[model samples]
Target: MENSDVVIGVIFLSQTIFGFLGNSFLVYHYLMLYFVGCKLKFTDWILQHLIVANFLTLLCKGIPHTVSAFGLKDFLDDIGCKLIFYLHRIGRGVSISSTCFLSVFQAITISPKSSRWTQLKVKSPSYIASCVYMSWVLSFIVNIAFPMYMTARWYNRNITRLRVFEFCSSVQHDKTSDIVNAVFISIPDVLLVVLMLWSSGYMVCILYRHKQRMKHIHRSNFSFKSSAEFRATKIILLLVSTFVFFYTISCILQINMSLTHNPNSLWVNMASIVAACFPAVSPFLVISRSLCSACAGNRIS
Candidate 1:
């Protein structure tokens, strides 16, 4: 391998290992919590599912790229390519949907008791579970056409190529199928972005109002409820903001790759790296929050 390739391989391997470990830690932590009979909050359930999705995403996207970067060519066969790409897309979709659900659920949870949104809090757990199930079903159904189109070079002898890369390629779809696929992929992403923004904005407003109200109260008489809400809102905002940043960059890189018709370009590697950033970083944020919360709880006791 060239020096540049080696460098890329090292970076990719490091990211894959870090993301895998972080996500694994999150999954293990939550599973232990469950087995120990600790009652999981609604958001905790969403978080556990998100961790699994992110871990799968890292594995599916990162492993192949890392292998290729290390000079291992054609590491995956046609079926393997299709399966990895399909599962990666599903995992990405689930992560987006789960994060959106988490934000909306928290928004509802922190709403004023008199507000209509707050009334849904009682049913939030059921709503979250239903949303998670629907997201998985929709992702699986929509991406079924993926394996039909995807193949490694060995399997492409009889097919008209849509786009060719060193790693994998897909057959060109007809106009209708292409449009349908585009819409299918775009809808969930667009909806999640909208929901995340609205929920984040609403939470920000709520936090601002609470801060204003607190200015009139004595410091010693501050409300623990307000503090907890503030912490939750801050964490959610941070997570949403970071996700949007990385996701937008990744999307831009992907668009560049598609439009340029060069799947082997450095942009592809960059896009994978950018996409992996969120999964690698998000788990640490959750761990930090959990540790802080635990410390705070212990102090209070």
Candidate 2:
């Protein structure tokens, strides 16, 4: 009933609604493209998975936070908490994996034919589905620890070792089990982040070299700016940078929370907002890029 709670609730509600609509629009647009038999780039498939994962993440992370912020409680049972937490983890995992894969795929796509990655570029599109499938499988299998530990939040409040959420609580595990689970979770995340950074750096280097070459060949700067490949690569770079920025902030907040023996709700809510930033903002970026591409095509024709 507090004004602060109302404001928080409205913020989360707005983010969830806008994110869902934007993602839905992209999904619909892609489906229409498929039905009309339009020629689609292989990267489009990776984006489809990303969009879906974003949608899932928004719903799972947003609705519960929104509801709790409004001071509603006890709506979720044990099963509900377990399912929501499990799905949210899976969605987050898939989102990270998909972004990493997309970055690597785009880097390969734009590599020169003479480069050592030429073989990978040629064979990569065929493996897109397999990679997506594996991401989903790995996400599901790795987060099984979540469901085992999650329970509906209890009002009795007798437990000291539980990690309490708005509607769910995680029972603390033994130190050994916790270490093992953390290792399994952290390793994949670290690998994906490293791959993303490497691929992004590679793309930046290629773009720089291309720009220098273009400077010698063309008097007008517009030639490089007007390129479709340039625009596409720019969009991917924007997405990667946005994701990394928000993900880093979220991780920092999480680490701060873990260092505190009893962190408050504000830190938790702030972390959730930071985590949701990329999902809420990324759809608009892609939509703008798509519109720009269409306009460029028309201009060329």
Candidate 3:
């Protein structure tokens, strides 16, 4: 088999394995969340929205491509390609938006009395539903143009040179397409990164303040609350950090791949794998925190 075959094979195996594992666990956890009588609190609602989005991401995009990589029937004809890519892009756009919402929600949840987000903190499940519904609608509206802009094009058999997979490719980026794509992608990415950065920075600042307060109180210079909360915050921080890192890497690789050419390039697929890893790990990390043994113990007591 050629290196292309080998590369695609490994890529398929990894996608299948990760897709199965991630989506299966996400489904299980979602079911458990529903069945365990855990009221769909605001944060829980956010998590559910995220889980649903990630599941869609994996299903609409990951699984079909995985099957195709394994030599499954090319069921995604022109129309199928249009719909699949459109829906997949919508779901992924939602994923990014939902994540931004999560970070903002968390920051608001932890806001001090002086903060302006305090008012939103008083809202309950109803507001949660409204926000989540808005998120879905916003995501859909933002990405609806994807299908409009993308069309299936068969490479002319005569053209000896092309880029990427030619069974379907966007026509050269026009002014309208360039504007739409940039607007859609940039807004969510910018909002998410900004929220993530602000929340993470605020957490560190608050932790610093608390540590100083502890030292002033105990005079011991060692603080248990600071240590413990940092541990919890660190988990969430790590999840966000890893995602940002991998996302940056994937984006850079995509830019490079577009500018350069190598059908045999391993980095291109590696970047896809990296981008896929975030959704794979995000849910379990959320589950790990939400369903902590301490919370379970508190319930028992």
Q: What is the lDDT of residue 295 in candidate 2?
A: 29
Residues 37-113, candidate 2: write the lDDT tens digits. 56566677788888988987898889999999999867888888888888888889999989898889889888888
Tens digits of per-residue lDDT for model 3, 171-228 = 4454575666766666876776787788877767766776676666755766554454
Q: Estimate each model's TM-score.
A: 0.91, 0.91, 0.77
Better of 1 and 3 by TM-score: 1
Please give the lDDT score for candidate 1.
Answer: 0.81
Of models 1 and 3, which has the larger lDDT?
A: 1
C-alpha lDDT (0 to 100) for residue 161 of candidate 1: 50
TM-score of 3: 0.77
Residue ranges of candidate 1 with Cα displaced over 4 Å: 158-160, 174-180, 291-301
Please give the ranking of all candidate structures by lDDT, highest first, separated by commas: 2, 1, 3
Which pairs clash inside model 2? none
> Ten consecutive residues with minimal summed lDDT in candidate 3?
292-301
Worst 10 residues of 2 by lDDT: 292-301
Give candidate 3's root-mean-square deviation (CA, Å): 4.3
Question: On a 0 to 1 TM-score scale, where does candidate 2 land against the true structure?
Answer: 0.91
